[model samples]
Target: MEELLEKLLQAVEFGKVDFKSPYPPQLKGENGAYELTIKALESGVGPQQILENALVPAMDRVGKKFSENKIFVPQMLMSAKAMGASMLQLKPFFTSGEIKTKGTFIIGTVKGDLHDIGKNLVAMMVEGAGWTVIDLGVDVPSARYIEAVNNNPGAIVALSALLTTTMVNMGEIVSDIKANLPTTKVFIGGAPVNNDYCQKIGADFYAPDPQGVVEHLSKLAS
Candidate 1:
């Protein structure tokens, strides 16, 4: 059982989605995350164990590697794709209440920003950490964020901005959400954002990378 779990984690960490995937030439024709996860479930491995031992650790390694510049966007995307394949098998458990999520996260690219790669990366990392992510997509307005919070009380909000010009919208969105939902924790990040700007905008947290966001969400969950 432990060996199977380890193999599943390796597949995810190396971005092996299934036996048909050929990106990692060394893992050619091997049973990837898709197959291993199903096998683990069929062999009586609990869904929680698959998530805690296999999925979470795999994504954590990917996040750390990304932070260290050991992997780039393409690799990260492939890893996310692998994780998504595993997640499909786990979704039934989640829907059936056999597995529990840590919390709800409402994430979006602030208004005037159309970039989604950064926001999507953060959303994927946060979701990999065991939270429910509500991605509002790009060009989301402040009111939309407020409405999402209103709908999902106690949810954390994360705003993303990729351009210097669009970053200004982050402040407005933060203030609006805070004004309406004073207890909501707002985290901000993007290429042009920094801790100083985060503080100036009155956001609760600022992450330079997806790992930072994962750490923040994990701490919040605990």
Candidate 2:
């Protein structure tokens, strides 16, 4: 069982989605995350073990590689795809209360920012880390964020903006959330956002990459 978990983790970390996937030549024809996950469960491996021992560790590795410049967006995307393949098998477990998530995360690109790739990447990475992600999509207004938070009380919110011009909206949204909820933690990120801007806006956190957000949330969960 331990060895099977290790193989599943390797498949996820190396971006092997299924047996048909050919990106990693060496893994060709072997059962990938998609197959291995189901097999593990069939073998009586606990869903929580699959999450903690395989998926979580694999995502952590991908995140570290991304943060260190050892991997780029394409590589990270592949890892995320592989993680999703495994997640599909685990979803039923989550729904049935066999696997419990750490918390809920609501994410969006602030109003006026039509960008979504950055936000999507963060959402994927966070979800892979065992948190339930509520994606509000692009061009989300402050009120929408507030409403989502109201619906999922105690949920963490992450705001994304790719353009400097549109990034100004983050400040307003952050202020609104703090004023209304007061206790909700708001994390901000994007190509144009910096730690200084995050501080100025009174946001709780600023992560340059998806992995940084994952790490921050992991700490919070711990």
Candidate 3:
């Protein structure tokens, strides 16, 4: 069981999507995350074990590598894809309440900002870290964010903004959520926003990278 889980972790860490994927030459012709996950389940490995033992750990390594600049966005994206393939197989267990996530995360790009790449990466990384992500997509308004927080009590909120012009919207959204929910923790990030802006806007946290967000969430979960 340990060996199988280790292989699954390696597959995801190395960005191997399946037996046919060839991006990482060393892992060619090997069964990847998708196949290995299904195999683990068929062999009666508990879904929670697979999540806590393999997938979460693999993504944690990927996040650290990214933070250290040992890997960049492309590599990180591939690793996320590999993790996503495994997630597809495990999603049913999550839905059936057999595999519990750490918590719910609500994320979106603030109003008037059509950019989604940053938002998407954060969502994927957070989900890989074992949080249930509720992505509201780009150009999301304050009302929408407030509604999502209302629907999902205790959810951590994350706001993204790529354009300076749209950053003001982030402040407004943060204010709206805090004013309405009062208890929901809000995290903010983007190229134009910094820790100062996060503090100025009354957000709970600010992460410069996706890994920062993941690490903070891990601390909260622990």
Task: List TM-scores for all candidates, in order.
Answer: 0.95, 0.94, 0.96
Number of backbone-clashing residue pairs for each candidate, in the order shown: 0, 0, 0
Off by over 4 Å in 2: none
Top-TM-score structure, candidate number: 3
- Number of backbone clashes in candidate 1: 0
In candidate 2, what are the lDDT values of residues 169-201, reduced to their tens digit?
999999999999999999999999999999999
- The model with the greater TM-score, 1 or 3, is 3
lDDT of 1 by residue, 128-213 (tens): 77788999999999999999989999999999999999999988888888888999999999999999999999999999988999
TM-score of 2: 0.94
TM-score of candidate 1 versus the correct structure, residues matched by position: 0.95
At residue 141, candidate 3 shows an lDDT of 94
lDDT of each: 0.91, 0.92, 0.92
Expressed as tens digits, the lDDT of each residue in 93-185 for candidate 3 is 988998899999999999899999988989989988989999999999999988998898999999999999999988889889988999999
